[model samples]
Target: ALYYYADNPQRPYDPEKAKQMLSAAGVSNLTLKYLIRAGDEVDEQTAVLVQQQLAQAGITANLQKVDPSQEWDMTIAGDYDISVNYWTNDILDPDQKTTFVLGHDSNNNYMTNYKNDAVKDLVAKARLELDPKKREQMYIDLQKMAKDDVNWIDLYYSPYINVARKNIDNFHQNPLGRFFLEDTVKN
Candidate 1:
């Protein structure tokens, strides 16, 4: 349970509520541009699923396939209305993900451009916190705040997998999906 918090916010599926909210806001016939990276079957499938879900909520998402080569530049520059993407934390640290992706001051804010003074303050404190428990609590608080802000929506996390020969001894993949082969020996 690296980053599991018992009180984490839960997003229950409520398409009716979404429709009601849109109606209350006087929004009708709403359509959004959804960016999907081209040449990825998984991404295309995900986009289709998301499109169907949004249609259920009375919102139309116009899918646009962007070339993988230019998707990063376009997404980072806030050029799209909505983009489907994923982030992998190779470092396996909450700070590594939060600082760059969510922090307001970070250059790699992932096109959200979300600015929150409280988030910035917490990030600074967590960075300097020596106690692991306190630091974890700080991150938990940040996560709660992030959920409330709703700047980014996390769909799902996919675990990294590796295939190797049975004779490979001590070949273990770390939590971050990194392989340290130096200590591994073949049988």
Candidate 2:
């Protein structure tokens, strides 16, 4: 699961390297109990793929199906071994994805219970910058920091499509996969 690199071609999959890292970290007889929403096909597919991949390195993953209604509570209560879930952001801001989700007092910090002062500070500083370039750079730095920490792994971005009549005006879908009816007008 950790060997995956979709964008970075430089980081090729090396089973030997992974095995060595696991051994160095004093890992042995590794088995992951992967949790998945019972009715979620995507989560099931991802879990299966990850299980198969991890098996190459002798890591056995036991898939556990959980009720979707109780899944969030389980994750929030930290009762999961490894949860496969997605976060939906309300707006197009890096803070929604990184800081608000992974920061302290966040509702969705399920994986590692991760909280870093540096990340919080970066997000805070970025929020204050009026210069677009400066703000972008600050978030970029935050992204790099999060990647280096390797606390969270994003699998994929699901596509969302919005349909509207040709005559509709001011119809635009934000990156957050949402649009407001108030902004639209018949032209």
Candidate 3:
């Protein structure tokens, strides 16, 4: 798809390239800082991995391990150039990403100050559109924009829980919406 292709589907990681971009934008030798939870195993490991990756690219990244209690507050105070976190969608829609993904948004969904006008327009169009084809195209456009913009590097989606009891009958799951016990009554 055009969206996936535009994101430089096969570019190797390079920090010099990243540095040059930052320099051009008046952000040089950017002492990129990161705030992570002190005891979370995933956060701990990821911070170490990023520290190594950025080092390969010639970027000085500072990792500050903070208490989980202070994580949100520190991030809100702009205490980091990057922050490691997680999210679970309430609904599977692009609009949900808009309020959270675009630069320093109220949702502070992504702390990276990445902003794209085209993406905003596309999201707006997608929201108002009822046509499936048009809506899908708009999303494709926005996703492509994200790839090129390098605003956020979507790593991976975690697994969700789906289990059934031994006596349970015909259980179904709606991936895009929440599950409620009341909605799971058996015949």
Per-residue accuracy of model 1 over 29-67 as CA lDDT, tens digit each:
999988889989999999999899999999999998989
lDDT of 2 by residue, 54-85 (tens): 78876888998889878777777777678766
Off by over 4 Å in 3: 1-11, 15-30, 103-105, 161-187
Q: Model 3 residue 51 lDDT? A: 86
**Best candidate, TM-score:** 1
Q: What TM-score would each prediction reach against the true structure? A: 0.90, 0.78, 0.73
Overlapping backbone residue pairs in candidate 1 total 0
For model 2, give the 10-residue run with minimal summed lDDT: 1-10
Query: Best-fitting candidate, measured by lDDT?
Result: 1
Q: Per-residue alpha-carbon lDDT of model 3 for 125-186, expressed as tens digits?
A: 77798887777777776666677777767555666778786776656666654665555654
User: Using lDDT as the measure, what is the rank order of every candidate, best first?
Assistant: 1, 2, 3
TM-score of 3: 0.73
For TM-score, candidate 1 versus 3, the one ahead is 1
Task: List runs of model 1 lying over 4 Å from the truth.
Answer: 1-3, 185-187
